[model samples]
Target: TLVKTKGKLSFQEPKTKGSIRTIKVPDLAIQTLKAHKLKQKEIKLAASSAYKDHDLVVANWTGSMIDPADINADFKIACKFANVPQIRFHDLRHTHATLLLQLGENPKVVSERLGHADVSITLNTYSHVLPTMQEDLAQNFNVAMQNIKKKSL
Candidate 1:
């Protein structure tokens, strides 16, 4: 579902304007996905005629789309097992954006990575993460001032 449509909410493909994006994944994620695909293939063979294949990277035992409730329940169980604070699945997006901003990535790049409508939206959502950038700017200004003083001497 498009979260911010001025007209009407529609159940369409996610390839809307400015929403479609490609992101690079690390080797660890690639390895995990490959392992998951192999496991899914095994499951498909075991289920045989009962299986309903959706070609999903994340799906039910029979390869159908998983229900939201099931996801929430499983997430909670996993969090408890890992001894981590419970967070909603949606929170992962926020975490990703925050980490990128904190790591000094350009806001526009982060915005595009997140598939936001524009950089302004990304700035509005993550401006708090720019305090580190401000500190870096201050240090750079001090270095420039010191260089000018040495040149004058």
Candidate 2:
């Protein structure tokens, strides 16, 4: 990640091998991304000769790396606009993991998305949400057994 300072931006590679894995995005996200790409096309046309064609998914209209401070400021403004609690940009990662776990996504999948070295880390980090998932699983099992018995008769 690169952080923009007054004079320059700093860059560094991931500290661990686990951070290099790809994330599987859902269809809805792909759709939204396509829409965003279309918007970027409009922006590129507007910027015309000045736009750098680096092919960034998220960048300034001139196709430059956006400033970190600007991203944070925009995030804060968006939070206010959406009437959500004020949270730092880093908090979104935690929120994404928590919401997905609570919604019963596979722990291994979540771990991969989070770039955790192993699934155990994801399970341990979100163990509090597991009890409810366990209960739901048990209920689903009961329903399945009932359906089997009815079909057998």
Candidate 3:
């Protein structure tokens, strides 16, 4: 995590032990990141001695850490260009969690991916998604019973 201390920005350890986690990235996202890394390598070569490699996934043209404010500004512009509602970049985390829950992903897995200290926190925060999941569960159960009956016959 990035933190500002005395007007200087620096990386810091996560607030909780649970925050240290390995998240499973989708194949498409992995591909995109690989492409970005290749592009970054090209940029690094172009920059030559001027490039400062902090090994960041996202950085400025000269390989310096991009300010969070700049990222938010760019995000806002992109949202405007895409004709989407403006939302804080941090809100994307919540959206990710909510979408996963709605898709019937196991809450424990979701909580781990989210780096939540406890699964209960994930459940409480996304309780609104549970109703839809409950309906899906009922439909799935009925299908399973029908399949079992068909097999027995």
**Tens-digit lDDT track of model 2 for 86-143:** 8888789989998999888888989989999889999998898889999989999999
lDDT of 3 by residue, 1-153 (tens): 887778777899989998887888999999999999999999999999999999999799988877788888999999999999988788899999999988888999999999888899999999999998999999999999999999999
Looking at model 2, which ten-residue stretch has the lowest summed lDDT? 2-11
| Residue 20 Cα positional deviation in candidate 2, in Å, after optimal superposition | 1.8
Task: Give me candidate 3's TM-score against the actual structure.
Answer: 0.87
Report the C-alpha lDDT of model 1 over 29-81, residue by residue, as the tens digit: 89999999999999999999888986778777877766555677898889899
Of the candidates shown, which would achieve the greatest lDDT relative to the real structure?
3
lDDT of 3 at 75: 92
TM-score to true structure, per model: 0.78, 0.78, 0.87
Error of 3 at 149 (Å): 6.5
Model 3 ranges with Cα > 4 A deviation: 145-153
Candidates, ranked, lDDT: 3, 2, 1
lDDT of candidate model 1 versus the reference? 0.81
Instruction: Show model 2 residue runs off by greater than 4 Å.
Output: 4-7, 134-153
Native-to-model Cα distance after best TM-score fit, residue 43 in candidate 1, in Å: 1.2
The candidate that wins on TM-score is 3
> Once model 2 is optimally superposed onto the true structure by TM-score, how far is the C-alpha of residue 23 displaced, in angstroms?
2.2
Off by over 4 Å in 1: 1-11, 136-153
